[model samples]
Target: MYELTVVVTKVLGTCSSEVPMKPGDYLTVRNGALRIPEGGHICLYALQSLMPVLTTKERRIGEKHSDDWVWRVHHVQCPDPEGRVIFHIVRSGEKAEMPPYTPSEPCPQPQTDPSLADLRVIVEEVRGKCTSGMQPGDGFLLKSGRLYIPAGRHFCLYALQATLPLLPAKQRAPLDGDWLARDNHIICPDPAGNVVLRIERV
Candidate 1:
């Protein structure tokens, strides 16, 4: 798989994030995993907006051309009407290594650090139509890094993407005045959908 790097290219309006995001902030995707700088944060809403195209961008397609939509479309904007953070996706041309495990080998155990807390992500409200049919009470749990959606119910992938990046940060105890400590809510990137989710440490 191709390694992809997403950079914050511009901010058109005030960043409403607890920690204001600006240009030069970036994150990397390697082997389907995300890496952000230590002590740095990326807007959850911005990540949700990028979810639809990130997988496609991580492929080794043909050379760049004007006709190819994937080649031409490099920038994505967060769904926040007030704080439109623009992201530029760059195909780094680096190949990501796959996990070194065979089919016969069992899957690795989930990380269970004493400092990391379990979490619960709940649908707080739905102001508009939720395409996935998620309701205010729909929710899921993240324990030992494994996601557990209640049987017979589901969580929206788009909505979940908005909260994934922040779960690890929230699992740990926050530093003095850390923005992640202050913010526990994430809004789905769909402007019309307006799905709000609350993250709680358990």
Candidate 2:
């Protein structure tokens, strides 16, 4: 898999958090693991906004002027209207192997892990037209690392992508003064869609 680094390129507005984000703050995704600087943190909202395109940005684009959206776009903005944090995603030009897991070994169940919490991600509001036909109260459950959408119900792919990167971190016990620990909302990247989803520990 390709390694991608997300760097904070600029902060147009003050971060709502006590610890303001600076241009040097960054996180890297190698193989499938996330790495952050020691004692460093990235805003959940900012990270969520980048989740939709990080995987695509990891790949090499053969054509420089191709119409591929990933090739054309490089910057992503945090959903916070006040913070306006800008993130730049670029391929590190490195390849990495995903950590090996033995198929024979049983995965740790969520129930067995007292520290892990199941989560419910629900649509709190749709500020603009949602092409997916989503509405307030639409939701899905995350348990034992599996997502379950109710039968006969649907979740928007774009909205779901926005929340995927944060779910694993939210499931674990948050570190002291972690901004992600206090944040519970993620906005869909669609400018027109403006779907807001709330995360709740269940």
Candidate 3:
């Protein structure tokens, strides 16, 4: 991230930096300037930190500017990706990565959806992604971004057992071998990895 110095030569209204800010990218409020994390490309949504599980990130500038640097926005420009013309800044080269947002809990172990393996090889590939992927209420690594399964009563996985009877025709049971039995017990991971069961039909 680039740092901008306050100058008396110019009337600072909403003084910004030379760096073109983006969404998902984060900046820290500092004494003299803001620290913009390098390679922190912005996304439409804010990244989830260990705290504030349900908070939506902000991108707009402060309502009004004051002489006090004590209060400032760690501005994250999450503009409409399709739209052009966001903001302007000076220019600077010094940059580095920002500290990662601490995770509230360790991510779950890797998982697989056997049903996805049935049809096309490509389908399996995508399903495999969703396997290690954060469940509806879990969070883990997803390639570059950290996926957070939203935490709330309304989240889908909160009602998994309720979904099974309605399971689509192609995925009524374990896809591969009949190794997984309804009456007998076997390991089957819930889609989000938050739950694993030695499920029995009884």
Best by TM-score: 1
- Residues 29-72, model 1: lDDT tens digits: 65544555533445656766788788778776776676578877
Better candidate by lDDT, 2 or 3: 2
* Model 3 deviation from the true structure expressed as Cα RMSD, one decimal place: 19.2
Q: Return the candidate ranking by lDDT, descending.
A: 1, 2, 3
Question: Which one wins by TM-score: 1 or 2?
Answer: 1
lDDT of each: 0.71, 0.71, 0.25
For residue 63, model 3's alpha carbon misses the true position, in angstroms, by: 17
165 Cα displacement, candidate 1 (Å): 12
Which pairs clash in the backbone of model 2?
none
* Segments in model 2 whose C-alpha atoms lie over 4 Å from true places: 1-110
**Could you give candidate 3's per-residue lDDT for residues 120-172 as a string of tens digits?**
00111122223323232221112112222222211122222222222222234
Clashes of each: 0, 0, 5
> lDDT at 51 for candidate 3?
13
User: Per-residue lDDT of 52-110 in model 2, one digit per residue for the tens?
Assistant: 68767766677665767776777799888998978777677634222222112223443
